[model samples]
Target chain A: MLEARDLACLRGERVVFAGLSFRLEPGGALLLVGANGAGKSTLLRLLAGLLRPEAGALLWDGADALADRAAHAARIRYLSHQDALKPALTARENLHFFAQLWGGEVAAALDALDLLPLAELPARVLSSGQKRRLALARLGLSDPARRAPLWLLDEPTVGLDAASVGKLGALLARHRAAGGMVLAATHLPLPMPGAGELRL
Target chain B: MALLARELRLALRHPADTLAAVLFFVLVAALFPFGVGPAPETLARLAPGALLAAALLAALLPLDRLFGADAEDGTLDQLLLSGLAPPAVALAKAAAHWLTTGLPLLLATPVAAAMLNLPVEAWGAAMAALGLAAGFLSLLGTAGAALTLGARRGGVLLPLLVLPLAIPAVIFGAAGIEAAASGLEARPYLLLLAALLAAALPLAPLAAGAALRVE
Candidate 1:
């Protein structure tokens, strides 16, 4: 289980959030909901180990998660607002780089997002939604048998269409069913069923 | 390394950055002959200084893009999260920058040296010095790039940050070539250049990595 206790965060000089707490178990999903400046993204970043909490502790299986950040980072797949793509690289090459870094099947990840048809195209030419799908393809690169346990997504559905959103929902379901966890920050209704909500 | 391979592939696809630096190196050296009037003795005397300056300035051209592009597109985040220690990320970038930008500058040094009317005998010494100079600049530039990342007018700030630190390499590189040109042993100057590179090889990336780790 992953748990946060009395978490607090500061962005610039302002306190974005404080006294925040949440728990995520194996095969669980949590949706972070709040208006702009509500610290949803900040919370996701904090949980992902990208940002350090000003106060409180993050525990994984009852151990301090932040104590070994590389180990904590190894278990997460974070998708930020930007697509994290090289515009000059072809879509397959883009996914291939990440696959090489994290150990996954590039072709399978591409197919998961139905991106095989556009695999040869440069990412610069991809539509905004397609680019988002390519970024989403990274999550599918995880090995089914040795998946990273936690996924932290920020505005994951921002540019996705209904069809792609459904595809993503299936991906999320498979992950949760396999004892993986998800914490997605979104203003729009996601296809996650039986997921809990955390309003910042 | 995956990051190195990606950086090389990206460099190949967008060869403009590498090309512009090489072209600038040659052009800057070529301009010295025009401005100083093409007297062989005068040109030869100015060759070492002129060549070193052009190479350093050309290398500076690409420093701003070193970490800027990755940070802007969120690639730096993925790199940070890749579980590769942040120092390794900076080191890989420095290696790639040296291959694409630094190697090209070294290759073009001969043409620039010829344009400056440098003695044929000094060509070897000049190439050696330039090679070390390129490597030193690559490490220094990587650190500078990381430091200036996310800053306003980073382009303007990059040279200002890098050029001062580069003076030692410039002095050693030019002196090494001048020593060899006058039939003197250039070992001390060359060794100093190598010492600077050796120090930077570990420290520059460490500094760059620390800067990158800052949220």
Candidate 2:
């Protein structure tokens, strides 16, 4: 179980959010909803251990999660707005690099996003939506043998098409079926079903 | 090693950044002979300082983009969350910088020194001293790059931050070349250059890694 108690955040001199609390159980999915200036991205970053809370405690399985940051990080798969690709590298080479860093089957991950046909093309040549799909392909690269239990996604479906959205929905369903948890912040509809909503 | 391999692959595909730095190094050293009269003795006397200074400046040219590109593309965030220590990431960058930038500079050092009329006796010492100096510069550059990552006018700020710290490398490098030219022992100066590298090998990555984690 993941739990947050009275979390607060500060951006520059302004307070983004304060006195926030939530709980996420095993196999649970939480969708974050808020207006443009709301703290959805900040909350996802905090949960991913990218940003520190100004005040509050985060607990995982009834223990302090932030105390051992590397351990916490190992359990997370985060996808931000940017595609995070090298323009000079081919799509296959790009996915292979990440696979080498975090154990995964590269070909399978590429296939998951239907990227095998364009695998030889340099990322720079891919369209914006294709780049987003390529980024989503990373989600499938997590080793099923030792899957990262928690996924923190920020605007994951931004540039994807209708067909790509269906593929992503299947991926999310499989993750949840395997007892994984997802915390996503998005303005669009996601594939998650019966998910709890958190508004900022 | 994955990060290092990825960095090398990226560099190989473009090849422009590496080529630009080396060309700049040779060109800068070549300019010195023209600015000063081409008298052989004058060229010989000025070669050590001119060559070393040019190499140092050339190394500085690529430091601004060392971390800037990764930050802009969001690759840095993935690296931070990869579960590898941040120091290890910074170390890989330093290694790649040396391999692509420093190694090329060292390979071209003899040609630059030759053009400057440096004696054959000093060539070996110049290469040795420059090898050490280049590695030291890579480390210092990594730290400076990380510190100035998100700052305004970072390209302008990088040399201002790294050049002062690089004085020792030039001092020892030039002295080693001068010693060899005069038939004196150059080992002492070369060792000093190595010592500076030894000190920076551990400290620079640590500082750069800490800076990376701040955001």
Candidate 3:
């Protein structure tokens, strides 16, 4: 399980959010909804252990996430809005690179993302949606055996089309069914069954 | 090890950048004779300074892209979230920068040496000095790149931040060549370069890692 208690975030001199709290168990999905500048992305960063909370603790499986950072990191994967791809590299190369980092199956993940045909194409030639799809494919490639149970996605559906959204919904559902927890921050409504919503 | 492999693959995919730096080193070395007049004694005297300057410029040219792309595309954030220590990632990036830019420059110094009319006996000493100098510059450049991550005019700001730090490497490199040419031992200058690299190897990564966290 992942838990956030009394979470507070400050950007510059402005307080984005304070005293936020939530818990996500295995097989659970939580969608974070908020207005622009509501600190949704900041919250996601805190959950991913990319940013520290000002007045709270993020705990994973009863241990402080900061105390056992590597264990927590191995158990979670966070996908940000930017694709984080090197523009000069081919799709296959990018996947292969990240696959090596995460110790995943590169070929299978590319096949699953329908990126095989564009595998040799440099990411600079890919469209925005295509880049987003490629980034999502990284999540798939990160842990094929579903060992990383926590996924924090920030605006994952922003550039995805309806078809890709449906594909994502199915992927999230399968992930949840397999006892993985998902915390997605999105403006668009997700189609996952029994997914809880948290509006900031 | 994986980071090194990934960085190497990335470098291979963009051969233009590496090629450009090497070409620049040779081209800049070639220009020295034109500007200073081609007297053998004068050419030999100016050779070490010209080579050191060219090496420094070539090594610094691509540093902006070290963490710039990663920061812009959010890979830096993912890396921060990857559970790897910030210092480790910073070191990996520095190593990558050296492989792509520094290594090529080191390999190309022989050609640059010939272009600059460096004395035949000074070739080995010159190359040794440049190799150590490149390694030192690469580490400092990585830290500078990280420090200027999201600043306006970052590309312009990088050299300004890094060049002052590069002075020590240039001094030691040129001193080694001068020592070799003057029949003095080059060990002192070489030692200085190695010591600078040693200090930078640990400190640069820590500074770069802290900069990443701040961003």
Name the best candidate (by TM-score): 2
Looking at model 3, residue B84 earns an lDDT score of: 74
Predicted candidate 3 versus true structure: per-residue lDDT over B43-143, tens digit per residue: 88999988999999988888898888888889888788776778788899889888888888888988988877787788889989998999888889888
Give the 10-residue window scoring lowest on summed lDDT in candidate 1 chain A: A140-149
Candidate 3: lDDT over CA atoms? 0.85
Q: What is candidate 3's TM-score against the reference?
A: 0.92
lDDT of each: 0.92, 0.92, 0.85
DockQ by candidate, in order:
0.82, 0.82, 0.65
> What is the Å distance of residue B156 in model 1 from its true position?
2.2
Candidate 3 CAPRI assessment class: medium
TM-scores for every predicted model: 0.97, 0.98, 0.92
Off by over 4 Å in 2: none
TM-score of chain A of 2: 0.97
lDDT of 2 at B209: 95
Clash pairs of candidate 3?
A: none
For model 1, how many clashes? 0
Residue A169 shift from truth in candidate 2, angstroms: 0.4
> In model 3, where do residues sit more than 4 Å from their true spots?
A142-146
| lDDT, residue A21, model 3 | 86
For candidate 2, chain B by itself scores a TM value of 0.98
